[model samples]
Target: LHCGTGKVSYVGGNSKSPALFISLLKRLKATYRRAKTITLIVDNYIIHKSRETERWLKENPKFRVIYQPVYSPRVNHVERLWQALHDTITRNHQCRS
Candidate 1:
C-alpha cells in the first residue's frame, strides 16, 4: 500500500513464499517504474528474511524493505486495514464453503 496515495498493490496465491514476495516486488517495480526507490514497510515474516529474498533484494537496488518491530502490529497501517476488512466482511458471515 502507498502511504502517500493510499494505492494498494497486491498479489494473491495459495501460500506466502519467497517467490511470491519477489513477485510482489516485481509488480511494485513495474507499477512505479520511474521511482528511484520503493520503500516497503513489512512484518518479520520468514519469507522476508529468506536467503532467496535477500539475494533478490541485492539484485534489485530500487526496492527497500523495512521490517516493523516484532509484535508491534499497531505500527503497520496494513494491519489496521486488514482488521477492518475482517470485521466488515468475514467476522460473521453465512458463506459456508
Candidate 2:
C-alpha cells in the first residue's frame, strides 16, 4: 500500500486475495513492529474487505484498513498509474481470457 511518504509494494506469483494482502500486512508489521499504528487506504475490492481480511485485522490491532468509495476512482492515485500502464502496455494486446 502507498502512504503519504512510505510504500509497501509486492509482486506475487499467485492471484490477489485476503491471504496475500494479510501477508503483506504482516511484513509491514515486521518492518514497523514498534509503530503504534499503520493505516492503509485501499480500494473497494472484494478481497480487501473479505471476512478473512477482517479477521486478520482483528488479530492485528495496530493496523487499520479503510476502503475508498465505490466508483470514486479519483481518490485513488494508483488508478491513474494503472491507466497509464494499460495505455502503455495492454491497450492493443490480445491474450487468452
Candidate 3:
C-alpha cells in the first residue's frame, strides 16, 4: 500500500514458491517501475528465505524486503487492515459453496 495515497497493490493465483514470489514481485515492480526503489514488509516464511528468493533479490536491486517476528502479528502493520477487510467482507455471511 502507498502510505501517501493509500493505494494498495494486490495479486494472487501462484503457488507458494520462491519462483512464484519473484513473479509477484515483478508484477508489483511493474506498478511502480519508475520509482527508484520499493520496500516490502513481509513475514518470515521459509519460502521467502530460500536460495531462489535470495537470487531474485540479488537480481532486483531496486526491491527490498523486511521481515517481522515470526509469531508477532502486531509487528505486521497490515494486520489491522486485513482484519477489517475480513470483518467488512465476510462477517455474518452464509456460504453454501
Choose the strongest candidate by lDDT: 1
Clashes of each: 0, 0, 0
Candidate 2 C-alpha error for residue 82, in Å: 3.4
Top-TM-score structure, candidate number: 1
Between candidates 1 and 3, which one is better according to lDDT? 1
Model 1 TM-score, 2 decimals? 0.84
- What is candidate 3's lDDT per residue for 1-96, written digit by digit as tens? 777788877655435887777777888889889989899887888877889888888999998888887556667878777778779986898655
Q: Per-residue lDDT for 31-65 in model 1, tens only?
A: 99999999988889898889999999999999888
Task: Report the C-alpha lDDT of model 2 over 1-97, residue by residue, as the tens digit.
Answer: 4565546466453578888887888888888788899888777788788899889889999997778875566787767766887899779996454
lDDT: the better of candidates 2 and 3: 3
Q: Each prediction's Cα lDDT score?
A: 0.86, 0.77, 0.79
lDDT of 1 at 81: 85
Q: Model 1, stretches more than 4 Å misplaced?
A: 90-97
* Residue pairs of candidate 1 with colliding backbone atoms: none
